[model samples]
Target: MSRIVLRHQEKRMIWSASSNYNLQPFKIELEQNVPRMLQQVKETDLLGTFHLAGPDAGITLEQLQSLRSQWLSDFDWNKDQAILNKFHHFTAKIETLAIHFIHEKSDRPDAIPLILNHGWPGSFLEFVPVINDLTQAAKASTGQDVSFDVVVPSLPGFAFSSAPPLNWTIDDTARIFNTLMTKVLGYSEYAVHGTDWGSGVAYSLYDNFNTSVRATHLTMAPFLPATPVQLAEMNITLSAEEQFEEDEAMNWNAQGNGYFIEQTTKPNTLGLALYDNPVGSDPRAGTPPSVIDHNEILKEVSLYVLTKSFLTSIYIYWQNPNGFKSSYTKAHTDAPLLFSAFKYNIAFWPAALLQKVGNLVYYRNHDFGGHFAGLDNPPALISDLREIVVYWK
Candidate 1:
């Protein structure tokens, strides 16, 4: 395990907390950072490879060339920055860290306060496409208008947010975010939604701050994947579609988890090596173009490069390598728990496996969409959230 030791003076300067902790307006600025990123992209030398085929083989040379070419010519960071700036961005000092978040309020006075969280290799950009939709009123199945005061925060150590202290887990994040919602933002209670690592924080928020957290929704769970032996012992049968999803998960465990191992055990080595390397910092691939287009993928890589926080962003894995070790049966919460399981997500947990996670009130298995639900299928994600928020206590 790597340790970040700060001197007393350094700790005083870095860990300084604001007396008022006011919310200050923030904007995405990349004037100086963009040119540096461009220069790095231009200077990259593609490594020769002779390996296996398919996703298991990792990114192909052609894909790297295409991404580099796009970053140089077609991809415009300014335009993407402007698009991101369209939303209302703000930052507030919470305890020891300054948190950057998008606080888009609905016009309706009765709009529910909701916080959307993103995970590793993802920034606040994941919710950009759906924030506007989430703020507007949607007609629910019961003919009632459903709108939300949407807040999306960059996780600690992510782009635009300060790095967390050593050994800071998602539970620590949940504590700070609960304060962001109830104390700083002055929301008495708020709904919660998360995917990937965000789901772990959401679960903690739901479990610990149940008084302030009204309801919770998740596209992913933090529990360990159930084994074939466990499923067989339980006599749980899988549908043909589910069997495919299972096979996909098995493949990911075998081939796609290299980054996880690196991040979990040797974050310091990997993070420093890839500090100025944008191509090396790109997020997960293998999603179809229809789910997340090439430009969108580049946008994420650009954020990591411009902010220079790829190192900090990966520290969560090191801080809590066993975050997913909890069993589904052990995760208990009284709040209304809704899970939207997309078929193509990295791991698929049927309702049967997830029902034990909490007081599950609503569970939907979407035939489409993947890990990045908001980017993959905004309409379905929006629809699912709007429909499920009605069941909030």
Candidate 2:
């Protein structure tokens, strides 16, 4: 119940319109000898060359080098600042930390309330497209200008939210969000949706605050049992679609999971590299920049760096190492859920797996998109989410 009241000046910063969110007078103090540390990182030769992987792996090294140079020189953080400023923003003191969020209230008093959560390597930006789409759809549907009163909070240590005062877990986050819903927003009940780590938080809220939450929707469902015996016991018959997902998970775990393991056990070490000098060479020795598409890596990395969010985001991983680990074994909710799996993310889990978690009122497997469904296929995702809201009503 500790509250940090914002003065007018602080509120102005928190609620400033997007056009004004620039890093003007940009004076973010780095630790003493930061330039020295950066020099060391740059001299390490960790980022030797660029490599394009996957089907696009055929992209020439020259092309990647050109893109990297352009991003380094031409990309404007101020432009992104303007785009984000268009939304109404605010912050609240909850449990000794300043909680930053974007709150877009629907015109209709009777419209349903919803809370959207984003996962790792992403920020409030992930919800931008869906926010536009859902609000438009709701306005059109009722013909009464009704829409969702959407609240998207940057998880503590993510984006606008305050950095953690100390090590904190996802359970701590769930409690703060629950209070935000009931106390701050004055919503007695609300629907929740999440992707990635956000999915874990959404499910935890459902388990802990079943009465306060109306429905839960998720883009990623890692809690789905992996074994065939477990699947059969849940009355799920693995479809051809589900089988494909199993294969993808197996491949991702084999090839892409080293990062996850490192983050879970020694994130601070990883942070020393990512946070100290994001644009510098990778801390891991002898890794070519070509191993990762520099454009995509830079895009993701720049978002974190410019927002001053790299440390906070990494702290979330550190605080909730168990959140990631426990995601595999968490109990299912009895409440309604809308579970959608993107075809490109087929390596994760298939729609058929929803049965293992809850009474899935709606389930779908989209063939067109990937892991970042809302960003990649906003229209389709919005349509699916709208349908869920209508059906629940």
Candidate 3:
């Protein structure tokens, strides 16, 4: 017999004090570093903004004062934490790390499990609107049994979840999440919803475990762009819709992708720079107040700053620089794929491209939403998600 050597390791799981496997009471403990962060933000001298170069054109001195004033006077972390605690929160030890997730189940027994994953510059808060809608949709007296058991997790190295092992990649994240659903929480099948980095994870779930991952709802396609030869081989042509998306993608690649390049190549450098600074912004000014609630942005900044994982969160970029574009391009899965092409999204795959990607069962061209579909337009997102159940069987 040939010699067989197998290296094995053991893991211990520490769970919350819930016995029902579905209900748990948890609280988010804010770190004591908020004061120091506040001090830094308060002491920000636009003395530099005057002599600042073009790249430093972030929030203006006036905007900085606004954020500072709000941070001091209006922002309340406890109240927001309580709001998050309204949903059932739990932690599962996947390996040596603790995975933090909000598991909100529909009251009805037949409710389907749907996992929501957030991306960069976003937190679990992105899906709160959708979660609230889905949780309440079935309970109303409307005689509709349409809802989901939503699971929103803090991606490894973000807000609540601990930093993944330094060498971990998105494939590892997908595998661990599979174990979380099946082995830990006891679900054999589930659907996934994601945006940005989370979109990559959702695709992997559907791709790697078809039996477990029944469907996927995503805002972005993680596949690499088709080569000229491949595009010619596939005889691809653009529709009016695709041309618009193409223009958006091109414009984004040209104008909005500096952060992408920096995060992928030198995350540590930029991460170190922004670790303590809460006012990080682009080379532009005057952000859209309508797209994201300023308070919501404050919450995101507070979470990143308080947890001290602002730098580690960017590790996702280093882990999957192309957001799994190379690996996913060759992937073809039986799992039903759904794409919500939000109009102002940074990049979008055309219907033709989506059809070539997976079993694209449902496609929506949302006119009002942006890159952050869940946050930008919850009603549309909720309706589309509910309709996904129609294609489930």
Model number with the top TM-score:
1
Q: Where is model 1 more than 4 Å wrong at Cα?
A: 1-19, 48-55, 274-291, 329-332
lDDT of 3 by residue, 1-393 (tens): 211111010011213212223323457877467678778777866475364435244345665567667887888877887787787787767776678898887765556678988888888877876787786554322334577878888899988788998888877888878877766666667788887888878888878888888888888877754443455577877667656666666666666677778889889887875522322222121243223655777787888888888799998888776574653353456878888887677776766677766888788886676776666777678877776676666
lDDT of 3: 0.71
lDDT of each: 0.79, 0.62, 0.71
TM of each candidate vs. truth: 0.89, 0.74, 0.83
**Residue pairs with clashing backbones, model 2:** 18-85, 49-290, 50-290, 51-290
lDDT-best of 1 and 3: 1
- lDDT per residue as tens, model 2, 1-393: 111122222235333432232212122222343334334434544346544454333335564455546555664445555666778777777768777777786554455678998877766776776785565535333233335778888888876677876667776788888877776666666788888778878878877888778788888864633565555675766668667766666665565455557777777777665521111112231232112234344445555655567656876765666664423343545678888776555246655555556667777776556565666566666766665455443
Give the clashing pairs for model 3: none
What is candidate 1's CA lDDT for residue 350?
Answer: 72
Candidate structures ordered by TM-score, highest first: 1, 3, 2
The candidate maximizing lDDT is: 1
Model 1 C-alpha lDDT per residue in residues 164-281, reported as the tens digit of each score? 9987999999999988877777676789999889999998998889787878899989887676677788788888878877777776777677888989999987787552222211
Window of ten residues with lowest summed lDDT in model 3: 2-11
Model 3 RMSD to the real structure?
A: 7.6
